[model samples]
Target: MEWKFVRLLSIGQIRPGMKLGKRIYNEEGLTLLAEGAELTVSIIRRLERLGIDILYIRDEVTDDIVLPEMVADETRREAVKQIRTVYRSMMNDKMGRMSYPHLGYSFRKMTESILDDLGSREDVLIMLGDIHTTDHYLYTHSFNVCLYTLTLGMAAGHSREDLFTLGMGSILHDIGKTRISPKVLLKPGRLTDEEFAEMKRHTELGFALLKDEPFVPLLAAHCAFQHHERLDGSGYPRGIRDGEIHDFAKWIAITDSYDAMTTNRVYRRGMLPHEAVDILYSGSCTQYDQRKLEVFRDKVALYPVGLTVRLSTGQTGVVTSVPPKTPNRPIVRVIEDEEGASVQPYEVDLSRHLSIMVSRIAEN
Candidate 1:
């Protein structure tokens, strides 16, 4: 089989004739453009409007590197569609208590599908940060959070039943945001103190929406309530501290914060995985649980495959693989020399070359 080389490129760097190396999906999870489709001026404009920041493009240097997907594309489409449905209903209803008869049954079924998909994988490292659309941030963010939280739950040796509850809570953790006004919710600048105060209300708002629902689990509702509450009692809605919060909420909090930081938003560009992890570590034992942070750091691909990075030795390469035990050290395939010249590509295993380091992400 012939292997295609693919490079991750920001949308601004992509040219009109460049072939898309990956399929583009809309907010509904329907295919907006199939893989190998040619980009055009109008399509590019539309994608920019949708707030898509990055895309995979065919390249000649990086070879035989295929990105991993934790769930089937069909499963993701259905999950996103379901999330959009439920969240939209909650956002549109003035009473905030629309009696959706299938709420519990539907979500439970979706959770099972996600778990089953996750079970089939041997190693799961989140690579979903590569593609994001700010307009659809809530829906995709919910789904991504669920995936990350469930992965952490499984790593922590949770039972299947426990996993189900965790998944539900993580997926709906931000349901309260549905009630916030779009003006404040999607603001492109730093929020004022008044706006942030209103934003903090999502926790209570989420709890109020989920607590009385017939099929929604009480623990799941609390997960929404307490996911923002820090270990140091600095979190809002109740100022709850460690042991005061449930274990499930704690797990959701770690993944929730990770996803929010790594994902692109209208207000700012997303941080790289390593950078986000650093911030998480900075808050360890104060804002976050210590042991759980270790588990999450190990599972993450700090430098994901296809990311262009610069080495301290002044070479440039795309990450080929991240070692499971040493996520910080990845195998990189160098394609350029220090002088910004193309070279005969070769691989460098950072774990073996302990003296060398990845300096930073290569500039466009």
Candidate 2:
């Protein structure tokens, strides 16, 4: 029904039309859904009281979807964990003044290192098919923006200095949000004009904060200032049109918006990856740079490892690897049948098996 990252998922909230990922099941085949002590009617009522919706048991699943452990490196793994922690802290701090000193440099440098190998492709895909699902919301958006920016810069054949500049810009793009009021930031409803204006002031405020940083890059200031500026002058802080905003700034805005929309917000649920793409499609080249967005679709993996998704066969399965060039499709391991029938484990590659498609996206 919607998109949810594997990390925030609770077994107690399992529902129909949702898909399961490899992480859904543990080494012993017990799932988060099977963690609670009992599934009795009284227990269900207790779960509901606690804001839980449903529960699931590990069903029969295909095996090939799980990747061999060889590809995941320990150092990269540890770094990824740290990125998530910092991202959440920053998101919570967006309402007012907050301290997050090293995040920008760290995010920029780390992304640069990772993209070094993925850059220079015939195409500008910054991630491999096998590795691109980001779990944390804020940092993930930061990372996604940088990823797209870097790759686009490369495709446009910018120099190393320019590439690094793009990275810095993307990471700091939302720094202005640090000045918005808390209630308005997390309001579970649409923002009022006054509240929205308060939010808009963040762009100018974010720019002010970085104006004095001694070693900060120029685009970093622009990132905070111009990321929200639109090609048609519909963006905030200023009525800047096409020639006013830099190519790199525009790139970050497009990636940033797409990532933010597909992520879970307190007031609203995230759009499915495919759905997010469709929404972006309408604005591509108009609100966004068409070429860069297309390159983004190439690098970003919608069905990342350890996530559950639905199949066209009316079954649910977990995603393991990225499919070749087909970011829309991926390798999946079946876990359950349409009737919720128990089935054995098996793997299917959407790229190889064109007959099957990711008919819908279900949450973990």
Candidate 3:
């Protein structure tokens, strides 16, 4: 039988001539390298310089696992293009009074496209395998937040119009960051108290930028404004508690934190999905809405396909599939024996094998 798996490797584990299993995109959402392209030393160096440390590769043991796309490439590319254009324009016009000619229409259409794409999927899970450069982290992050927010909104039985509003708010939630200095915004290390205070101003600045815009909805502006607010009033800006916070902003808050923790940055590696979820749960009913957090956790693929994991039985395997109903328990294809010997591969469905458990993610 043909084994279906994809290997996730770090830059240090990659070598010349390995075929790429996924497409890499540039800041403009353009394809930097096509899928199945051979990697060379020079190519690897260039990717490293671009701050890409992880990649998915096809090999003898992992060749046929076709990961599903939550949104089409074209849709994501166009949305990123729009985000870059609008954000850069706002940054250049520091006065924040200039009008964007088609800001409202463009984002409305993009939100609709995302909703449609997500609706078409039989089972949607938040998978984190997309390739992007560090320089364009904001734009990519905006798109991802929008995806996660909308998915949760749909799961909560939100109306179509509500989903559009949530999408718009999530996508442009960080528009205020464009006004912040790159030095502080892109600092490679932890920010000092003073610097952090300055960074926190983005919420108010974003509100000022969007509140009066002709095309932007007032609720959407509040999403940017209050997304940082926590349940117990420890958050920023207004320091509002549960009822004071808008439902939309509360939703955005969960997605924003989840994505931030799970995405790579200049300073640190991204945490695995399960790790991030654990942090989220720790803040339940205090920092986040417990009901919303539970919904978000259910929609995330804790052990995404292509990830390497170790089972409690001391066997190692590559994740092949994740059932939406039981995302925590994925189907793993064992490739190594407990004694560290190479063995004929076999499939293990953790949902059925109740005695077996995923001990940890392998570091390979």
- Residue 60, candidate 2: C-alpha displacement in angstroms: 7.0
Better of 2 and 3 by lDDT: 3
TM-score of 2: 0.65
Ranking by TM-score: 3, 1, 2
Count of clashing residue pairs in every prediction: 0, 10, 0
Residue 127, model 1: Cα distance from true site in angstroms? 1.7
lDDT of 1 by residue, 17-90 (tens): 98887787765566788889899999899888877777888876764776777777778889999999987877
TM-score of 1: 0.93
Overall lDDT per candidate, in order of appearance? 0.85, 0.59, 0.85
In angstroms, give how far residue 41 of model 3 lies from its true place: 2.3
Sliding window of 10 residues with minimal summed lDDT for model 1: 1-10
> For model 3, which pairs clash?
none
- Model 2 lDDT at residue 2: 17
TM-score (all chains, Cα) for each model: 0.93, 0.65, 0.94
Q: Is candidate 1 or candidate 2 better by lDDT?
A: 1
Clashes of 1: 0
Which 10-residue span in candidate 3 carries the lowest summed lDDT? 1-10
Ranking by lDDT: 3, 1, 2
